[model samples]
Target: MFLQITGYMTLIGLTLYLGLRPVSGRYFVDMATYYNYFQNYSLGAHVTSSKDVVFHYFMKFSSHFMTAHGFFLLMDIIYIYPLYLFSKKYFKQYWYYSFLVLIVSFSFYSYGTNGIRNGAATSLFVLGLCFPENKIKTGICFITAALFHKSLTLPIGAYLLTLMYNNPKTYLIAWLAAIPVSLVAGSVFVSLFSSLGFDDRLAGYLTGQGNLDVPVYTGFRWDFIFYSSFAVFAGWYFIIKKGFHDTFYFKILNIYLICNAFWILVIRAPFSNRFAYLSWFLMGIVIMYPILKQPLFKNHQLFISKIITVYFLFTFLMYFVYYN
Candidate 1:
């Protein structure tokens, strides 16, 4: 009980720290953009951003009463609070383990600060998954997430598809096949994805035209792909090899595979990390869910502690080494 309280308070404190960060683009990619937009909207500027219609109006309305820093606090609340709720819903008293996994995930800090909208939407997506039996609640969460960031369509669509067909083996096979396919015909997938017209920015990513101002990896990222493969391996190991069976795990694993497979096919695109995040956001739950639920290892507590250390170490390394 004490640890849980401590964890929750710590996460709450983190939300505040991130939200109130001094507005700058040095590392927080979208922080300055959000600040400028909020200032303009506060001055009675029109909210013309239709891509995420609801989110734009949200900012327009929020700016009327609060400074940009206050708005960031609100958004950070939206982004981080849901992790607590979702972990509580699933893990109960043991929720701290899941919460710790999520906060330390490689993309967690960056998403909370830089990809603010995506962070907010993905948090909603995780929360929505918590109440699968309640269609009304789930639908509302999913819809709101989409409005916050339309890129959520991929995962939400994958969830709907999972309802229709929940087959992990097939998805795993396809996910594996995507590597060689991507190596040989990555351009084909790019053209096909751009044709879908999900977002105009898809084209920019495909043509390496996105973020000319922001330097990012455009070529094949074998290291990143290798990093992402951990969830795939973990899922298959628990479900197929060890014969773990749970409806919720099935749903989560399938969605992770489907979404990660799409990223695999487009792994060479510019800002592909953004695409990878659609799946990476769920990596914590995907890998830790089964382990926490069933004692996969003999010394479960020690195992979890070690896993937490290794997981957070990835973020630590990225922050200091790669990000530097």
Candidate 2:
């Protein structure tokens, strides 16, 4: 009964938070384009030679704006259920607390509004993380995500590497080492993407085109950084003290942190803020599992949780009332 209440409360809270925002209707535009492109499969063949027949079929069948948006919403909801199952199975003791932490985090809002493929892909990746031992099943999940967005190839490739490494320490060390390389290679990566036939328009948007002084709502806020750092520390404590041994999730979290840290140093744009969502999403699992199981910081936990909740509420209200 408590679980049911929490779940409904979460759904209501998310709905109220997201529903009140002015729908820019950007997703509708993208969906329409996708639908049109799929409808012209021969044109799709001319555009890209890979078989995305399933994606094409879905778009073809669900051509209307309402149907497309409904599909997107359904995918978003479906993606989170596996996360719930994973949280319950592994961190049963702290599932509610963890869910609350995730709900209060602004990552959910950012992803929902972004209307980009990466956001959807990340959700599916989380679902994949929930089932580590089932490699074949996990591969299918990763492949499905790639169909939604190819950038996920990075994390999916990292998952495969994690399978190769017998020790988490090795994976961590390698990830740390790769951070500097990735930062330096970002320009090369951009060029490579351009050469590989990705739309320059899309690439420019992702990397942030020439600076325009715009009212940025999200980015590397000092507050977000502080909270993320605390969450990372909490994860470290949990793993070391409780011997949390989910190597796949740990590898994903470590890579995410390293990449975000590198991005913070190298990139400067509100668009870069997407990395925070990835960071916080994984951190939710890392931080909450420990807190749920031990409750060692019971008094401090509740106090901090309440403070965080109030802060999010204030920000949400302020954004709607003043910023909007």
Candidate 3:
């Protein structure tokens, strides 16, 4: 009990410290965008997203009571709270591993620092996963998340499709189809988005007209493919070899597969990588859970844990030092 309390408190302290400090260097685009939005709201500039309008006005109203840092602090709390809840409930058997998973998920930090709304949205999505038995509640959470960030449509939409045909073969077919889809995804995306009356910024992204300062999408990212290949194999091993097909880990693996399919198909589309984060963020858990459960590593869990911690910490520190 004391150990659990200490761990939770440490989580809170770390979140507070990181959330308060603004990200620096090349990753400053989204922060700059937020500041621009704040200024625009202050000047009564017309914005397209009513959700953004509400968020902007809320921040404006909040300014009367707190500084900009306070707003970020609140958002940061909202973002992490659901994640903490999900880890506690689902990963209760391996609580420390849950903590390590959160610590190692760099994408979570990227979303939190770059697009806070998406961070909060993904966190809510995590809660939806936690309550999988409650379909209505889960649906409501997913819709609410979409209201915050439309980019969620890719992952959420594909996940819905998975609900229809959940066989591994279906996912495999989708993955195979991605190569052909890559040829036309960019054009089709632009046309469809334009017809749907998407916002200028998003439309520009699809049409390749805007410079949103996001990473340029080169086709067939080797790094993503490498990680994705491992995820696919790990997922298959857990489901087929270990008989964990009906488990939550299997569900996450499937989601990762779907996300990977979309990524492979539309590799050149701007901000397409965001779709993968829906599943990629859960990679730590999917990989760790099965390995930790295996009898071969039971005796060396602590040693393995320490090594994992050191590697992730080194990567995290290097990211901040070099990228920031």
Candidate 4:
């Protein structure tokens, strides 16, 4: 009882710390961009988002009554509160454990700081999926999520398609096929995808034409391919080996597989993590949700203790050692 209360307390403090961070490009780069946008809107500069209209309008509306810091705090809430709600709904008593997994995810902090719109939208996507029975509520959440970040359409569309013809093996096959295709086709895939014009930024990523002020790497990113394979491997072990045929779990696995495969096809693109993140955002949930939901081991608590340690250790090593 006391532990759960403390967990919530810690969550509140963490949220506030992230929300109140200073606006600086050296550190939360997108926060500075957003601050600029907010200032423009506040000064009647007529800001708009052709696709992310809700986001621009929200900025426009918020500019009237809030300081940029407060707006950032609100964005943090939008990015984080949904995770709290979903963890509570799904994990119940052990809600904090699942919430902790989400917060500690490799992509979570970066998204919140660097890709604020995607962060908040994906969190809402997580919350919206919590309501499987309420179609209207789910639809609204998905639509609103897309309006905030159009890239959300990839996962949202994948999820909806999975709902219709969800065969895990089929997605797994597609995911594997993408690897060889990407290896052989190489830059050919990039040019083809860039021509689609889904989003201009996406085009830039595909074509290595990103607008940047710092050196960026572009190549066959085996490190990321291995990282993404974690989900594919874990899902197969749990579902195919251990028989976690939970339809919802299969859907999540399928969603991750589909999106991850699309990312693999564009593995050599600049800032491709932006594409990989569509699935990486689901990694912790993919790996942790099943373990939390089922008593797969005799001493499930002990198992979870070890899993959490290893999980966070990997995140720590990756961020500090590899990334730094």
* Winning candidate number (lDDT): 1
| lDDT of candidates 1 onward, in order | 0.87, 0.55, 0.65, 0.85
Clash list (residue pairs), candidate 3: none
- Which stretches in model 2 have alpha-carbon errors above 4 Å? 12-23, 26-57, 64-69, 166-202, 205-207, 210-228, 240-249, 298-324
lDDT of 2 by residue, 1-324 (tens): 776677657765664444334334353334444434644643334344344444555555444344434555554564455566666666664465655666555566555545435566777777777677787777787888778666566567656655565454553454445445545565554445445654443354345662323345433345555555665565555566657666544675565555445444423344545444545556566555544555455596675477457647854864586456
> What is the alpha-carbon lDDT of model 2 when measured against the actual structure?
0.55
Model 1 lDDT tens row, 246-301: 88888898898889889888887777777889999999999899987888788888
Against the correct fold, how does model 3 do in TM-score?
0.79
Q: What is the lDDT of residue 282 in candidate 2?
A: 66
The better-scoring model by lDDT among 2 and 4 is 4
Superposing every Cα of model 4 onto the true structure, what RMSD results?
Answer: 1.4
* Cα lDDT for residue 284, candidate 3: 65
Tens digits of lDDT, candidate 3, 51-71: 435455555666556656677
What lDDT score goes with residue 317 in model 4?
88
RMSD of 3: 4.0
What are the RMSDs of all candidates, in order?
1.4, 5.8, 4.0, 1.4
User: What's model 4's TM-score?
Assistant: 0.96
